[model samples]
Target: MKPFLTGHEELIHDIKYDFYGKHLATVSSDQHIKVFDLDSTTSSWILNDSWKAHDSSILRVSWAHPEFSSSKILASCSFDRTVKIWQEQPDELHGSGRRWSKLVTLAIESYAPIYDVVFAPNHLGLKLGCVGSDGIFRIYESVEPSDLSQWALTSEIPILNSSLPAKSLQSSFAIEWCPSKFTTTEKFIVVALDQGFIYGTKPGGGKDDLQNSPRQQSPLQQQLEQQPQSQQESRYIKLGNLPEHNGLIRSVSWAPSMGRNYHLIATACKDGYVRIFKAIETAKGDLKIEILAKLNDHKSEVWRVNWNMTGTILSSAGDDGNLRLWKCNYLNEWKCMSVINTSNRSDNRGIEVEPK
Candidate 1:
């Protein structure tokens, strides 16, 4: 892979590619956001726009679905305790260039430094989800798609199911929505705090086609269905939590199910292990999670784990300064496919600030 310099004054915290994979966006501790477009002829990325987006370190950046507008849309969260939305528009003054304009700032309900922000899947409309040091997860939806500045807070839920012994001053979180195209009954999201938790919504109206699925309830399913009617009628509810994590989870990713009957999730944890969980839906609509693999090859605090588009492979990065690729073979055992060591690289462009 070719690497290019971003020319930021400080370290970058997050980078994301747009839905079409033709553009790239990055947020940096310098509090600036930069956008780049891929040059087809040269097969290289060209910087398209750059602007100061926040008052403090920007932690994450997410691209809205391309179908949302003719021009691209982006969302960013920062340690400044705010999230901002931006849209690309022609430079009115310059008349020959394009620039990104801030559409709105969401800070009213923010209580702590925001750590993560992500856009919901395309089918879910233009919704943004964010989590912060306060351990609260908040969702915002566009009140009117055509009017970018108008947004409404639709839901806010604490991530942890049980109270911690005391307040955590170092808490951070990451979240990802299920990217399944086949499931029409409900939408699901997984959040990582000290542990992983799966939250879901009940079918909103009319009739659910999966209503006829077998009614033999699993223990987990029974507990979820036993929640008070208030929770059952809410926009979203806590469906289940994952196995305990040894240390705070740094990142979590839900693999695209690709129409499979099961779901796959991966987590990067400060305990120096990358764990993969396989979740299967019972006939009664309960989710049963089994540990598919526990990999300690990193031997250092892993910071991120992500699945390929097809969910056939996973790539992890960590403090060890190695990017490792993993895949499952015919025997259904996961093994390291390759490792790219960046620790000894002499290129300044490869250097990154370790996450605090």
Candidate 2:
């Protein structure tokens, strides 16, 4: 692999490729976001834009599908307790030059640091999901494609069990929206919490209203029922929670469904393990999840997990400074296919050699 120096002063927290993989966006602890464009003629990544984006470390960045509009859009979350939306603009004076301009900023009502933000699939109309230190999951929708600044908080759900004391609620670490919708009328979002539990929730109010909708009663609803009548109304229904992990969850990813009957969800944890789950729709039309694979190849905390565009391959990075790729075999067993070491080493000339 060929590597180009990024010159980031601090550790990069996340890197994402655009829908077509023609552009790359990287966010770092230095509170900066940089965009790079791949030049087809020279086969080189050229630095296109760089700017300070947040007051603190930026944790995650997400790219909206280009099909949403003619120009690309991006979303980023940070430790500064805010999420920002960016739009790519053409530089008419400089032909072939494109730059990103901040379009909107979303600050959580609680002013909590957001750990993750992701754009929903193209089928979902310009929607974004975010999880944060407030133990709350929020959904924002842009009603007008021309005016992204007019985003509305479509849904807000407290992810923690209300029966538990407020102090017991833990911050959420990651969240991902299911790429496939069982029907044109429904959507799913999976979230990972620092309390070692992963839960799924469906934002209410689609083609059908919540009162007329049929779904299994979740723990959140049960807790909500115990409260006063004024608090009974909710726009989100908890799907269910998965088995607890050994340690806090760091990242969660849902694979893109490619005409598959079941969906795959991968979670990376502080326990240094990567677990994959199979989400299947039961006869009653509710989601039933079961652990498909538990992989423990990392010696340190597993920080991130992602699925390839085809949903056939999974890749993970960890505190061990290594990235591993996993694939399923003919027997339907997941196994590690390759590992990339990122640790630095000293060479013969007293020079440091970094992993490519």
Best by lDDT: 1
Candidate 1's residue-wise lDDT over 37-89, tens digit each? 88888888888888888999999999998887888899999989999999898
Please state the error at residue 293 of candidate 1 in Å: 0.3
Q: Scored by Cα lDDT, where does model 2 land?
A: 0.73
The whole-model C-alpha lDDT of candidate 1 against the native structure comes to 0.77
Off by over 4 Å in 1: 92-98, 161-169, 190-192, 203-233, 346-356
Q: Least accurate stretch of 10 residues (summed lDDT) in model 1? A: 212-221
Error of 2 at 54 (Å): 1.8
Clashes of 2: 0
Number of backbone collisions per candidate? 0, 0
Residues 150-217, candidate 2: write the lDDT tens digits. Answer: 67665666776643224455444677777765542344555545443333333344322333322222
